[model samples]
Target chain A: MDVVLQQLRHTYAAPGLEARTVLMIDEWQATSGAQILLRGISGSGKTTLLNILAGLLPPTTGLVRCGGQSLYALPEDERDRLRATTIGYIFQMHHLAPTLSALENVEMPLVFGRKLNAGARRARAYELLDSVGLRDFHRHRPLQLSTGQRLRVAVARALAAQPALVLADEPTAALDAESSHAVMDLLQESCRRTGATLIVASHDPALATRFDRVVDLRNGALHEAETL
Target chain B: MYELKLAWRNLANRPVQTWVTLTVVALAVALAVTVIHLNEGLQRGIIRASDPFGVLVVGAQGSSQQLVLSTLLLQGLPVGNIDGHIFEELRDDPRVALAVPMAMGDNIGGARIVGTDEHFFDLRSSQQAAPAFQLAEGRIFAADFEAVLGSRAAVGLGLRIGDQFRPAHGVEPGLEGDEHAEVHTVVGILQPSGTPFDNAVLTTVNSVIAMHAEALAAPDASTTTDHAAGNDHAAADLVSAAETVSAAETVSAAETVSAAETVSAAETVSAAETVSAAETVSAAEAAHADDHAGDDSHAHASAGQVTAVLVAPVGFIEANQLWRDFYTGAEAQAVFPGRELGGLFDLLNQGQEILILVGYLAAVMAALTLFLAIYSATESRQHLLAILRGVGARRRTVMLVVLVETVLVAMLGALVGRLLGYGAAAAIAGEISRRSAIPVAIGWLPQVEPALWLLPLALGVLAGLLPAWQAYRVNVVEKLFPS
Candidate 1:
């Protein structure tokens, strides 16, 4: 379940502009079940690196191997499937589909997986919602939930597929200090319980001490911070 | 299945838009359906009403359409009568299979009392096998002054077996006060024949000839109050009565006193009211064939005179020969009821085409409305689509959900519209049966009704195509990440 990145670099091209490189990293590694922090200044491509690892964006010249499979080497649909089964995502603003309930948002990945019947999917979603302390609010829509509660639901949804790696891009940026700490505790606890690698991308320096490793994405390079 | 569920949930989320879209679609389908069914029913109703008199009509040469409309359809006013020799010629013609005489211009209430014999019931021609008249209650008319009521006529007038009603002199409204001394007794009530005959009161031509002769012998004995003044319009009442004096009463002119010509001499043939060349005949021995259904004309007491002769020749050759003879003859003109009806529908079909054109336009508008409504729903929910894509739902599934949503709404609306269209058409047919003698029965229109449902479904699919594509090509990262 370990994730390996080798010589990954990404660039953006628009008409009449030089190709601008967004992310470049020689190599990075995470053991299965390890928690890590990625810190950088604004516009340093911390989110871009996480997107590549999540198989959402292919790197310009590198290999992303999650759970021993090269992600970008496969077709887009297969890559999507691999992402569905092997990597989970937590966006910055708790982008839960408003059409689905809190519990249904957690169950969405499994629905796309097509591997479980309705009864089994419901049971799994119930267990996860209970684990995230959203059992009573399982039936409530995302709009009806508090900000912290919404992020907690997102944490439950990210772990629903039992992925090998979970990527969080500024997931707690909009929360209060206490709520941010609580959201982080829920995400770390959930990832630890599932033995999945956790990668948090944020500009906040205070989150540096809470992971097994800390990497700084600065000027398209990865530097290991001293403390982690 | 999951995609359909998601689509339905999305549609349900926008209740107002969904209902408005469905309502527009239903109304559009209903309008199209009504036009289709109405056209179908009216055409069939006209055929039903025309089936009994599928014959060549012999009448005085004027408006042939007016003759058929009055005699066969029991509507309008008869063109003047023809010589009884013409009726005898048709009856003796070897090619003619059926020939029944008609005399008109008398009424019991607003219902016309037609003078025809039992042979009128044996009608069948090129159109279809007309069900012969059978008694539902009593027997056919036997002696003069005995009447046979049509099925609907009996029902409408609330008459039964042996019920006697006095005859009025004419079909005009005030003529009920111009009652004749004869009290006609109803001897029979006919079965429902699904024709205009079902609304008429039928009797013997001999009886009509006898009654008119008695009126001619009495004072103020002009026919239709027209011979003296030639002014028997529907509203001619007291003035006509005050001026009722034909040459038969004033000049004691020959039985061929030229009633239709008023006081003028050396006039058109009907001026003598189609009185044959029977040189010697006394009153009460009048032509055995006149119908004074409105009592609008009185016959000269000749041996041969009839308003119209229903002649069902053996086949096309005989019918053509007979029509040619009458067309060339000076006394009367001949008419084919089916051809007259065909021309009527040809005119009516033009108006129907316009209505159908409007229906097509409504359908297009309904389809466009479906397109715009579905497009907006998908447009506003692009974020949700992006989220689903982000969560590993395939683009195809997202597209299918949108397509399924639009079609589901359209199909539901169409189902309801089909019901309403048929209901409206059946109601219209019922009205025709009530107001006129046309017996219209509307069942499922197998020929064109399926298109009503299928048209909307195809439009639903077509309308959904663009919106589904929009949902498919929704930019995932732009919507999800906003970076």
Candidate 2:
């Protein structure tokens, strides 16, 4: 079965600023395990499109079907609950609670998880931190860790709940060249191992080669679609 | 939980501010507590002082207040004598259990000298029904010439039993010589009764009589000595005249003196006559010098026609009849001691109430100062509150934390304040009472009724609620928000 999207469009307006309609994706169909990339330069509505798909924001006009449920059809709290449990987001700037350690940061998703035992939550958090290759740094807070280490911790936290789709927004933007390659490699390897679909929105050419297909947006509209 | 944790940390964070507020609250609460106790004690003391002597009596035309002052307080402008004959008559009555005649006026070293018979000691009483004057070392007066000293008088004058001290005959104290009378032996010293009588020197009825008699008679040897000392060379001339003149020649010279000299002497005589008629200067002087003398017999008789009597009937029925009879007969008034005391208390109670109200107001203002201190801390600790909220603490839990912390601080302040207040009162009570002449009593750690704690507790609750409410209103969502 395919997670479906048909005739998707969105309009955004800022006071005393011109309004714009974003033609995100029209009649797109993709299988559950298919990976996609949204390629865009700055201000091309990449994050905006991700927000709509994740149910963080409502679409002006759209029908999005995921696991046989309409994303926009539920109330705000229900939509939030669905997004929290079923979708994983990795933003450009990873927001880890400064007071909590690396392992605790990875445990964030499980905190909202259903009646899971403390042992289970702790074990999952440990497993994710280890998978992100920061097993020894589990007790270090975000400020104490390197930039790459913090991003890796954020990626581990995102996938801790085992969501079906992982949407990353420039996850390697803050890293050096070598750290960026390593983070992309870990993201692709982890997504492939879990069989979870990965969609990355980035201007970095390195990420284009990591994903199967890339779709580029120009001037709030789709300009090109390509299979790498 | 959230609020208490926040409150405790908040208070800890600003230790100086918390301490200052706590101190202010403590001091005020302590003051309030001490004042409340003192006022209550003073009221009780005054009431006790009032009822020591029973059934105070005065003239028919006199006010109850005047009667209280004249017969009991031994003060105020004096009225004409209530008749020594009537006094004698009253003493002779079969129904009369005890009669003590009080004659006042002369002051010795500024201390009042009361002249009365030995019955004055018998009639003397205390609020607790204890003997008002107990012999500390020796016996009461054995003869009319003997004297008894009050406790303070004995202590202040440095006199003991058997020590002789002269009783002055004039309104002025320390009037020495035969004009004043020789020092009488202090045969007895009365125990401290905490009454005005503590300062008085008790002499027999005769001593008072001798004092006034000296006033009417020629000047004696001591007065002559003092006058001689005061007039050095001038006195020697008088001594020579006394040596040279025969009794017959002196009499002839007195008869031939100038008309102006006679006129001036007549003026002095007229002034003396007016002075004697006022009764306080003369009779009080008489009463004070020798209390037992019969020289006031003529004056008492002349004043008897206008005087009224006080009769203490045996039972309630007789008492009621006496009141009715006095009111209806001869346009006289009879006042019950109990009712009069109540009226006096009622009048004085208003002033006492004002005093208490001011104290309460001061306490409230002090409490506000404490409240402000706590509130100021709450405002400064907003970030700390946010941190606590970010934890698993609930709003009510945070409120309780603030509540508990404030209550604890307030309680501490109250305890400290009370200790300070007690110490302050103890240190200065004597000077205050002596200077004011209002007769304040000093006691260490004066009794504080258990119920008084309610005031501090109430203040604590109020001071706590303000800070607790502030902590409760801390918005968790806003704290998590960037702005």
Question: If you score just chain A, what TM-score does every candidate get?
Answer: 0.93, 0.91
Q: Is the docking of candidate 2 incorrect, acceptable, medium or high quality?
A: incorrect
Off by over 4 Å in 1: A11-22, A40-44, A59-61, A102-104, A130-139, A170-194, A202-210, A226-228, B60-69, B75-80, B104-112, B124-130, B164-184, B205-305, B315-317
The per-residue C-alpha lDDT of model 2 at residue B254 equals: 29
Cα lDDT tens digits for candidate 1, B1-483? 778878888988899999888888888888878877787777787777776675688887888777777777776667777666677778778999888888774666656778776677677634466545778888876545568998888987888886666566666444334655445668799888887778778876544544454345443643447322334421121212212434442232233233312322333322022222111122333332243222212232123356788888888899999999988889889988788888878877887799888887887888899899999999999999988877778778899999999898899889888888888888988887776677777767887867887889998999999999999899777787776
Chain B TM, every candidate: 0.79, 0.68
Could you give the interface RMSD of each candidate, to one decimal?
1.2, 7.8
**With candidate 2 superimposed using the best TM-score fit, by how many Å does residue A166's alpha carbon deviate from the native?**
23
Writing each residue's lDDT as its tens digit, candidate 2 over B393-470 gives 345655676777677677777788777766666445455434222344645432454445557667777977878799
Question: DockQ of every model listed?
Answer: 0.51, 0.05
For lDDT, the strongest prediction is: 1
Q: Which parts of model 2 have CA positions greater than 4 angstroms off?
A: A1-228, B1-16, B23-35, B59-61, B73-81, B124-130, B167-182, B212-313, B321-334, B420-451, B476-483
Of candidate 1 chain A, the 10-residue stretch with the lowest lDDT total is A77-86
Fnat, model by model in order, equals 0.45, 0.00
